[model samples]
Target chain A: MTSHPDVEALAFFAEELLEPDEERTVAHHIETCALCAATLDELTAVSGVLADVPPVPPMPQDVADLLDRRIDEAVRERAGSDDTATETGGPVAPVVPFTRPKKRGFNGMNLPRLMMLAAAGAVVVGGGGAVLNAVMSTQQESAVGGSAAPLLQEEQAEEAVPDAAQPYKPEIVGSGTDYTSKDLADQAADVLDATVPESGYGAEEEAQDGSILIEECAVSLGERLGVRFTLVDDARFEGAPAWVLFAPMGDTTEVYVVDPAGCESPDGVLEQETFTTR
Target chain B: MDAVQELPDRELLTRHTQGDDQAFAVLVRRHRDRLWAVAVRMMGDREEASDALQDAFLSAFRSADRFRGESQVTTWLHRIVVNACHDRLRRRKARPSTPTEDDTLDVLSNDRLGRVGGGPDHASQTEARLDVHAALETLPLDQRMALTLVDMLGYRVEEAAQILDVATGTVKSRCARGRAKLLPSLAHLRNPHPPRDVTTGRGGANPS
Candidate 1:
C-alpha cells in the first residue's frame, strides 16, 4: 500500500527476514523507489564492511594460564564443598572470586590486569603499565592522598593476592611506586570535570608551589585514568585557588587543581604546597 | 589439553560442569578465535575485551546449570560474552574515540596488527575495517549486538533473538536501526557498484 517500507523492511529484505509476501512487497517497492533501493544498497554495504573485520588474535597464553588456575581453584573449592555437603549435609555456598568488589570510586580492574601491572612493576616496562604510570601517577597523588584516604581504603582488599612475592592488594588503586611511561594504562573513557572546592588558596604566594609527594600521589591515581603527569605549570588561570598542574597524556590535558592546603579540606590551602611530575 | 582440543564445545562444557576443569581449557582453545572476534568487535578495546572474555568464561563456568540448552553452545557463550562487554562499556563512561587510519588501533591484540602497514593494499583494507569498528562503537548496545549477531557474525534473526533473549521483531528493528546508523557513518566505504561483495563469512556475502 505504502511506497516506502522503511529501514527495518530493507534490512529484512537484505537478510530474507521477511515473509514471502512481505519480501515481495519490499522488493517491489525497491524496484519502484530509487531512494529505497539506494538505502538497501547502503545497508548491504555496511554488512559487507563489518564482515571484513579481521578476528582478534588469540588471548595471550599467560592470561589464559591465569584464568585456568582461577577456574581450577573454583572447581576444587566446589569439589571440597560437595565433600563437605556429603559429610555434614549443609548447603554449599558458591565461591565468590572477589569479596565486596563493588566499592565507590574503585575501578573494577580484572585480576589478570592487576597481575600484569604487578609484573610490569617488578620487571619489564609493560606497554599497559607505562601508559598507566604516565597518566595515573599524578591523579593518585591528588585523588587518594587528600583527606580521602579513609574513603579510598574503606574499600580495602579482603583477600590480598600474593602478587610476585609481595602481598599486593589489587583493590589498592593508587600504588605509590613511580610508574614509567606506558604499556599498562587504564583507558579513561570520560575524565570528570574539575569541581575544585572553593578555598582561600588563590593568593599569589601559593602559585608554583606543591610537594613531590603530592605529585607522586597524583601520578599514581592518574595512571589508572590514562593521564600522564608531564610537568607542573603554576596556577596561572584567573581566580584559580590552588597551584594548577597540567598532566598531558596523548592529546588531552588533565588539569590537576592542587589544593594549597596540602589536600587538607575545603576550608583552606596548606602553606606553599604545589604539585610537580616526572 | 591437546587430546580434548578436538572435542565439541558442548562436550567440553558438560565435562567442565561435571567438575573437570581441564575440559574447560580445551573448550577455551577451541573457541578462542571466534570468541576473540566477538569480544574485540563488541568491546572495541583488546584489553577491555580480554577482561570481558575472562569474566564471561568464568561466569559460564560458574553458571553452567543456568544454560537451558535452547541454543547452540557457541551462541550461549557469545551471549554471556556480549553481556560482560556491555558491563565494561557501561563502566567505561567515555564514548569510544575513533582511531586515525594509520593508528595501530589494535596493538595489544597481537603482533599481526603491528605489521598492518603492508603497503596501500593492506593499509586501505585495515582503514576500512577500523572505520566499520568505530561506527559500530557509536550504536546503542542493543542495536550493536543485534547487528553484530545477525549481520557481522552470520546468525539468523531468530537465532540472534534466542541468543539475546529478545523477540525476533526486536532483533530485526535493532539490526535495521544499527544498519541505518552505519550507512552514513561508513559512507566513505560505500561506492557505486562496489567490487567487493564477497566476504568469506556472514550476511549477504556472495558465495565464493
Candidate 2:
C-alpha cells in the first residue's frame, strides 16, 4: 500500500502528540525520512521560542477601578429590587413568582385530583391501624420468645468480641536510641513510601531524641508521573515539624526534606525548589 | 453578604440576575484583565480593545439570564468579546482606510519588542518581529483569531473552538494553516537553507 505525505501525522508528532506509541512511530519516521526530520526539527525550534513569550500586561488600574464601581452599583440595584419585592409581599416587576394559587371556579374536579385525595384518605386510615397492629404483634412475639432470643443475643455478643483481645498483654518494643524526631521521620517516610526516592534520605544520619518539636519542614513528592502535592505548612507530626513537597517524575512520586541544619543556614531560606523528572 | 467582598463569577452572575449591583462589580473585577488582553490582541488597537471589553461585559450583564453555564464563565465572556471585536472590525473596514503617521511609527517602533535602544538591538530581529505583526494582520479574521487564541494566548484547541462556536476539526485546520502561512514571514529568524526533496509514495516528490 502506498502512504501519503502525512503532514498531519508529522504535525501531531511535532506537537508532542502525547501518546507513547505514536511518538515512537514518529521518531522512527524522522530517523528514516530526512525531509520530515528537518521540518520537524525546525517546527520544534520555533515552538520553543514561541513558548517564551511573556504574558500580556494587566489592564490599567483606573479602568479596572471604574469597572469595579459600576459592577457594584449594578449588583446593589438588583439586590434592592429583590428586597422591595419581599417587603411588598408581591412579585418583582419582571420576575413574577410562579407560586400564586390558581382561581378555583373553572371546572368539575378532575379524575387525577379525585384519585389523589382518595388515596391520601385511604393511607391515613389503613396505614395508621396496620402500623399499630404490627407493633402489637412484634411486642407479643418478643415476650413469648424471650428465653430463646436472650440465648441467641448472648451468643452474638460473644462472637462480636475479637479473638486477638482474648489473651491481650502489653508489650514494649525497643526502637533502640531512636528519638521522637526519628519516629516522626519514620512516620513521614511511611506516609510517603510510594513517593520518596530510595537514595534521597541519608541512611547514616540518625534522628535525634527529644520531645517531638514542631518544626517547619518542606515536604515534596519525588520525581514521578502523578499529581504534584505541595504541602504548604511545616506540619507537626507527633511533635517534629517537617516540610513536605511533592513532584511527579514518571510513574512514581518523590518526597524530600530539608535537613534542620540546612534550614537554619542564612540563605534567606529557599521558599521554592525544583524537581527533576527521572 | 458584605457587598465589597469579592464574589466568584458564578455567584456574581446569580446576584446580577437577581439585580445585585455589587455582585456585577465583583464579576467585572475578576475578568476585566483577561478580557482586555483578548480584545487588545484581536483588535490590535488598545483604545478599541478597551471599548470592546467594556461593551462586551455590559452586554453580558444585560443578558445574564441567557448564560446557561453550558461552557466555562471565561469561555462565555470570550465569545462576547470576539463578537464585539468582529463588529468593531466591520465598522472600521466600512470607513475610509487612513494610515496616520503615528500609526506607521507605532508599527515601526513596536518592532523593538518593547525594548527601545536598551539591550542587544539586532536589525534583523527587529525586522522579523515587524514582519510577523504585519503577516498576522494579513490573515483572514477567523484564521487570525484562531491563531491568537491557540498559539499566542495558550488556549486549548477545544476551548478555542467552543469560544469561536466552530467544530474542533475546523479549529485544528485553521491553526495549522495559519501557523504554516506565518512561518515564511519569520524567515529571517529561521534557518536560511531550504530542506531537501523527499519522495512520496504517490509517485511524486515535494520539498520540505
In the order shown, the chain A TM-scores of the predictions are 0.30, 0.27
Which run of 10 residues does model 2 chain A get worst, by summed lDDT?
A164-173
**Candidate number achieving the greatest lDDT relative to the actual structure:** 1
A7-43: candidate 1 lDDT, tens digit per residue: 7678768767788999998888888888788778878
Model 2: per-residue Cα lDDT over A1-278, one tens digit each: 14323655665565554269877877876787877776666554344333333466898875575455434433433444334523532221121111211211113433223222222211110111112222223323423453223233323322331111100111101111112334533433333332211111111112222101111222111111111232212333234443443322222333333333354332323232222223
Best-fitting candidate, measured by DockQ? 1
* Model 2 regions more than 4 Å off: A1-33, A45-50, A65-278, B2-6, B90-106, B109-129, B190-208
What value of lDDT does candidate 1 attain over all alpha carbons?
0.50
Q: Which TM-score value belongs to model 1?
A: 0.50
Error of 2 at B129 (Å): 4.6
Q: Give a tens-digit lDDT track for model 2, residues B40-139.
A: 7777666667656655775576556767888887788888888778655544443425353246446555644465543435654554444444556656
Error of 2 at A198 (Å): 82
